[model samples]
Target chain A: MSEQQKRTEIGEIGEFGLIDQISSKFTNKNSSTLKGIGDDAAVFGSGDLLQLLSTDMLLEGVHFDLSYMPLQHLGYKAVAVNVSDIAAMNGLPKQITVSLGLSNRFSVEAIEELYKGIQFACEDYSVDLVGGDTTSSPSGLVISVAVIGEVQKEKVVYRKNAKENDIICVTGDLGGAFLGLQVLEREKAVFKENPEMQPDLEKYDFIVKRQLKPSARMDVIHELGDLGLVPTSMIDISDGLASELFHIAKNSEVGVTIYEDKLPIAKMTYDTAVEFNMDPMTCALNGGEDYELLFTIGQNDFEKIKNHADIATIGYVDKRANGLKMVTKNNNTVALQAQGWKHF
Target chain B: MSEQQKRTEIGEIGEFGLIDQISSKFTNKNSSTLKGIGDDAAVFGSGDLLQLLSTDMLLEGVHFDLSYMPLQHLGYKAVAVNVSDIAAMNGLPKQITVSLGLSNRFSVEAIEELYKGIQFACEDYSVDLVGGDTTSSPSGLVISVAVIGEVQKEKVVYRKNAKENDIICVTGDLGGAFLGLQVLEREKAVFKENPEMQPDLEKYDFIVKRQLKPSARMDVIHELGDLGLVPTSMIDISDGLASELFHIAKNSEVGVTIYEDKLPIAKMTYDTAVEFNMDPMTCALNGGEDYELLFTIGQNDFEKIKNHADIATIGYVDKRANGLKMVTKNNNTVALQAQGWKHF
Candidate 1:
């Protein structure tokens, strides 16, 4: 290839564009692969059930900063985040394979400490640590985890299943993890400015923990199963709530209208946002990494989960021509925008 | 957590040592995970059959220098190596997930070129491209792939099954890939020193392609089954012949005796080694990344496969007390040594 032909930028095509270009040329030949490449996890059909597979990679400087991030929390976060992808497909994670590339700067004990948190997450999620590869890197650390999960054929969910007038629901709360990251960054800056100053992180512990050790909403998935309800469409909130909403809307060929008054924001998350002079509503809409489940349910199926403690109805699916909109508490309407994480 | 504690160097323990240290602490709780951490791939007992899981990571500088390597070959090699691990387990690869970390230096076109090679490998290996994550990295490219394969319960082979008097065998030829890398490195040095000179890689095309596009020996694995022979023990020849032999011996509690004259060396590889003034036998024994299957078969299964063109009986397993030794054409015995690639 000539030098001029090699100078195109990845950002020009964007992430989704690149994925479309890559996935378009391949065809799945195996009958076992019932679904591939477009969902939270690839679904494989066994005789009586479906097996889910998903993988994620975390780079050192790009994904986390060692100065503020504890190795154990990083380990836990890695497992939890990958498990969240499996949960998004309404599956129970059974096993995970973690591969790590480490530099000599990491000691055996440091690696042990990281594994300790990995073990904790495994136990918490009822998953097994099956296999992994560890090798030396020239610089920094790289972690790639592949998770396997199982679900019944009828229980599996996809992003393109939402219907007209379906109720959009979100579990737990949003923006807390994003707010938590903001607080950690502020404290990191304060510490860097003066050697004598110590980070006063006690008051912001909830948000910080949300950022470091966020849990996947496996409880919501189980409860929905118990209630005999399958979400019309589903996705986990990793790349901000608005971005996920756009994904569901685009894939389902529908629009969404979310009520700000119904948005679930933690008290601490709201107060911290106010302290930082940021809009709490915007944080809930655009803040990411919450690892919470967001989905839409058929109108008749809503009665079963209406009283669930952890779930809240935030909106309803509408015609695409109506567009995505948010209703403020004062009855004013505004267009919803997604400020997704742009790594490039 | 104290700094006063002494640190243990990873080199002291080596790659296997570090892996043993880490894997020993974690126990598998999920019944689906039939085996973990010790073999070429983890065995999953889903039902009547066994599922094999294997993962490998290739870092930019540590694994390959992009300056001399094409992105497409890098992509193809990544998938092939992971598939080779599955082949080592005597299984049929069914699916693979590829996660890539891209830096700003890479363009969308460049990524598409990489995926072109990936799709070609997927087609060649008959594996489905399942799910994967695409994220941006701070520096160079990182590709991590996890492969899923299947084998019958009775057909599965492990590294610990070699017995006394088992015949050791290797597929295809050895040392070509390593010598190919040497030629490429020499050409790279010439190009770096003088920008005017173009690399004359045409003369070394076969060896160079061996280095860049080594295919997994799945065909040999399939052929062995047709011949009604199962390897008592098996491993892929990635970390040189001697090191891999040491692995089988250590795991199986046996020793080996190989003949230097019996080692398979391609004509081109032999001539290139001679041109480089390196010992051809040494190159065949210690050179790595052949992507060839090395196995030990019971004496009863020897006649069934001896006539096959690609497979060769190189040696036999011995008692642990005899140790690993090589017999020269002159009837001189020498202790075998392994200097596998050391990243540290």
Candidate 2:
């Protein structure tokens, strides 16, 4: 680098812009690569059953605090988060490879506790723990997981497949995980100020668990399969609902019209957000790490999932000109903004 | 975690020991998971074409020094290392997902330079960069890559498949990479002590390049396919010749016997080792990061690869009771110990 050469900070473009720049430079040469770069998982294979590959990396200080998080939940969340990517593709996770970079600060027993959680997740999701590389890190603990999944070729969904007037649906409630993180941070701060503080986490157990060991919405995918319902478009809500809607809208070349009143927030999550003096709706729209499913289905397929207990029909897809907007209880419409979990 | 509990350091078990312990506690539940935990890459898929999944994570301070290693070379090496795992399994890499943790210290242009090397490697090795996650790191740069590969189910090789009397062969020379590291470190120390000193790395270019950006032997894998020869078992030589031999021996339930005279050491590597007062043979046996191929072919297939220039006939498989041993040019035999690249 010469002194005259201009340097651009990564924060200038944000992660999505950087991703787009990187993905645009490469082209797929293999025919088996049905899809790449844009979806939750990369799709490949020539058989009737296609394969899904996705990876996620969590650094110790950046992604987790470890002060309030047990190694067990950290391990479980790492697997679940990768598994959620497969679910977002309407695929069943078959196997995962975990690569860890550990510091000497972690003992053998501590590492075993982490693996125990991974084992539990394997059993719960019916995915096998196959291969991984474990090495030493200079500083914090690092966990990177890559998962393989399988889905019927015809049933596979991408973020770009939504059609106009499609019914938008979300599995389970949102914002709980974000609130859980907030509560954990608050408690950690409290504990730091007073060593005798015991965290008082009993009152916030549900939300804290949501952050620590959020479940991937595999159940919703299986149920959709059983009902013979296929989503036209799908995405995992790791970056909050509003941000994910932009992904679908941009990829599908369609606009979204979600009802703010239709959004589902758990009773506890709603009350907890209020306690923090945060608007529950804002938390639902912008708070992330939910690991829930946000997807769109054709209007005709909505009948099949209409009465489902966990699935909520939030809104409908519209024309690109309409843009992404939400209808509030006061009958006013406003454009949706994504504030998608920017670590940069 | 309890008051009376004992904590064991990970160094006590070492990396292989920790991996074995973790692998023993888990069992494959998915029938699609044909080979898991023990192989170079996890094998799955039910079709005649089997799928291979493998991941490797590299950290900044632990794996390389940016003081000498350019980011471009780092990116190239990261992808190549993962691709090597696929080649070790007798498979061709098709697609890869890279997860990176970057600190603010890097510019967008620096990342682009890094990706330039990755793109070059992708073109060189014929692999696709399908998906990845890039986030802010709290400390040093982190790179984790997972690759997906395909091979004929019957042709896929595992470490446990070598037979008695098999001819052991290695692709290219060994010890160059390890010696390259010694030169770089020595130059770094010299330069650190006196600011005016240049590295004077001109004569050591070949060896230094070997350490900075070693190539994966995918070319050899392709050549084997063209020659209609498949090794009974295979493993990439990332952890030196003797250590990899032990892997092949232990996994195959056999023993190895290699002649010291036949060990292929490049002229440059041998000279560099001598310059550092290190035994060239010891450098070949225990020095790591070579990224070459070590495998065993049935005695009948010797005619197919016997005349190959890049392949060296170094040893042969023996009975398990015989143990891993090396015969010196002086007509003396010694047990080979694997001081596999240990960071712990």
Candidate 3:
């Protein structure tokens, strides 16, 4: 409490380091709190079915830009990302609460448009918009969403449950959302530089939509349910695949060995990354915001999903001493590095 | 869709109007969602025990000034207010998720101080800190909290169940939080005008504490349970007494009548208001952020809490035709007007 007290900058610790520091000081007191700060979603309850809770906050200028991002897409993306967290837990989202802090610059109609998308997502996910608080912000919009989901206790998955020989799989694709962001940024720059010039977005539609209206893989969750498959470990790729792989490795006390040839990247995403003079494979590994499902299934369950079209077997788990590495198409082995999104 | 299109400003409809507009467009698709919107908390689940979910967002500048409001109290208050929403539904809070948007101006220690307050509230309320999202903000701090609680299906209270003859009651005193804010703002102004001037806060400790660290009335909810009585209707007084009374009336389809002399007001709060050249009774009625419980209990349960030390019987519910009126100490009746907080 002194003026010359020790001061540590938040940037020095970064996001994950700060999380570890904060979580270290606290201990869970409730018996029903099955999990707390470490996982994608907090788990609780003693019944055969347990509840999951997760929240995400998006600031207007930091997480989005009104100049290019539509309010409707922003609303939809907000709900979708939270829904993705529930899906990552192998749970079905039942209810969600949205809290918004809006400045007076926003019109009632603008808010209506935002809610229209929220309603669309509510219907799409079959989740109810239960309750929220709307208050005035001093500046930009602040949207925070909290979702409640339920999963059968026997089938619940955590990042720490994967075994040494589990198979790693990713659904849909990766790098598209990140590549989509690059295209949008380029267009925004062009539009800002010359107001009279028309910003051509026709060719970038696929990646643009990937960034703006990315869907949570509730479909994949349902498919997994139908396939009668439960992953030993699961995570949503919101912060790049390599970063999440590190999480799985650290939590599960295992190493990862992925093949570059097997990394899921759409043709459009690859071509766009190439057009931007970026490595396509690097983009797929580090370009986050895909909201794709990344899970590890035991080898015994591999026969069930191997022929599935949307899913790609990307890697296999290894012993903790093996470390995380990738094998290239040329048969060269290299260490995998994670360039995760750094908010700080 | 065009620049010439009609656009209604949010100021025209205010906060409640915006909420009504949003809630009207959405319908519950999940059978587990027993209640959605238009209440202190959303109720879900079909079991003998139902779940409650509620969220609140607090913004810097609009909600608090860091110059006077310590980060610790801000964190405690952020949790307390959300827990108050659960208490309003006569439920016990069990889990909470805190989402914080912070600017780099805050140090790691500053965030730790903030979390310390949150930890204190978690201990006080016996609610587990389940999950949360923390990200960088462009400007000031933003805090959003969502809480999940549980209540017996038969005992859960709602805003729309007050009967004509139910006895309206309030716990603790009112207007103290508002008076505290007045004192703090005055002190801030004084300090700003003359940096050399030391704030004389000793005399205003009680009221000031009320503003900075208001406690949710969970204690009263426990007491009511012990007395084997459940309120027919209830709401937390966050936007002042008169405003909340109107909510109960509109939701329950009943009228409200209260005695002016029966309204609880702390002596210090009354004295501080007088010093500020403000009406003490008006502050108690229209001054917001008190976070006290206002409820209506059946007359048959009157004797159960007749001599309760903290609870004060203010009036009785009335037929809708009677209108909302207050009987003055001078034997004159005046229709109550709600000068609620206008965030816009």
Q: Which stretches of candidate 3 lie over 4 Å from their true place?
A: A1-4, B1-4
Which lDDT tens digits does candidate 3 get at residues B1-344? 78737699988988999999899999999888999999999998777878899999999999899999998999899999999999999999989998889899999999999999999999999998987998999999999999989899998999999999999999999999999998889989999999999998899999899899989999999999999999999999999999999999999999989999999999999999899999999999999898999999999999999999899999999999998999999989999998878888
What's the ranking of the predictions by lDDT, best on top? 2, 3, 1
Q: What tens-digit string does per-residue lDDT give for candidate 1 at B1-344? A: 56748687777787788888878888888888888888899888566678888999999888888988888898899999999999999999998999999999898878877888898899889999987888898888899999988899899999999999999999999999999999999999999999899998998998899899989988888888888788999999998999999999999999999998889999999999999999989889989999999999999998888888888899999999999999998999999998887876
- Give the distance in Å from residue A316's predicted Cα in candidate 3 to where it truly belongs: 0.5
Error of 3 at A189 (Å): 0.7
**Residue B97 deviation, candidate 2, in Å?**
0.7
Error of 1 at B202 (Å): 1.7
1 or 3: which has the higher lDDT? 3
Q: How many residue pairs clash in each candidate?
A: 0, 0, 0
Q: Pick the candidate with the highest DockQ.
A: 2
User: lDDT per residue, candidate 3, A20-79, as tens digits?
Assistant: 898887788878789998899999877888889999999998888888899999999999
**All DockQ scores:** 0.75, 0.89, 0.86
For model 2, the DockQ equals 0.89
